[model samples]
Target: MRGFISLLLLTLGLCLQATGMAADKSVIAVIVTNDNPNKSISLGELKLIYWRKKTYWANGQRIHPINLPPDHPLRLQFSNSILGSTPSAQNDYWNGLYFHGISPPHVLYSDEAAIRYVQETAGSIAYADACKLDNRVKPLLWLLPNGETTTNPSFVNCN
Candidate 1:
């Protein structure tokens, strides 16, 4: 009976640990084409690019920033973290920019589509759930929940 109780408690502890770990997987993987010359981008520069205030890469390639739909969880997290606003606030920002002939980033439906778009389009950038990332494109930044950024994927703690 003591052994059974120990096993039950152990299982419960592990389940709770797993739930905590899921929260860590929320780190956003900011990806770019494999051929992109940039290996790292600061959060501020990323915001500029996404906002269309910075129009070109260091090599003079035009920057193409992509976004997920407004309702996507990753999008919400990204907007709050990198863009420094809620998704709705971002829409309003864009709405005003529309009259100035400035458009928001193109929206992709899924992480896979974003990955593929980044892979196929030069000078493009997008974010995906770190765990959902494969090798199609290289991750240039890791946006952590703690408001910090990392260029190293090993530091992302995806598991």
Candidate 2:
């Protein structure tokens, strides 16, 4: 009986530890300006914009979708959560668009660059760690590990 009780306690402790570790992982927020005077974009709409399927905002302004580096953690998270695709799958999708004379969205090397580009260019959108967000741009979406939206306006950082 004593041994069983000890094992149970150990299991509970491990479960708690695992949960804490997962909670520590940062949630990334994809942001854009609210002042664009365009309709709030749905998840599908956002995917279309980022994938280059839709190239213009409702105001007829050209949309610029900024992307993270191929191997960036936020990029992987964005691909999986927003596009329901992997990095390779995203590449394939982009390739298909490129081969047909359609251009994919422009890619940036880092989150800082993406943010800077968005800040400088109207009708532009980008993602980054919530903690790094500044007054330059506004947030559009919050991505979760399970592909769900978060009500929290901040990004979570596990590191």
Best lDDT goes to which candidate? 1
Query: Any runs in candidate 1 off by more than 4 Å, and if so which?
Result: 1-25
Candidate 1 global TM-score: 0.81
Model 1 per-residue lDDT tens digits across residues 24-116: 538889999999998899888999998899999999999999999987778877987888897788777889999999999999999999999
Query: How does each model score on lDDT?
Result: 0.88, 0.76
lDDT of 2: 0.76
Tell how far residue 86 is off in model 2, in angstroms: 1.3
Error in Å for residue 66 of model 1? 0.6
Across residues 52-120, which tens digit of lDDT does each residue of candidate 2 receive? 888898779988888887767777778877888867777677687787898766778877887788888
Pairs of residues clashing in candidate 1: none
* Winning candidate number (TM-score): 1
Worst 10 residues of 1 by lDDT: 18-27
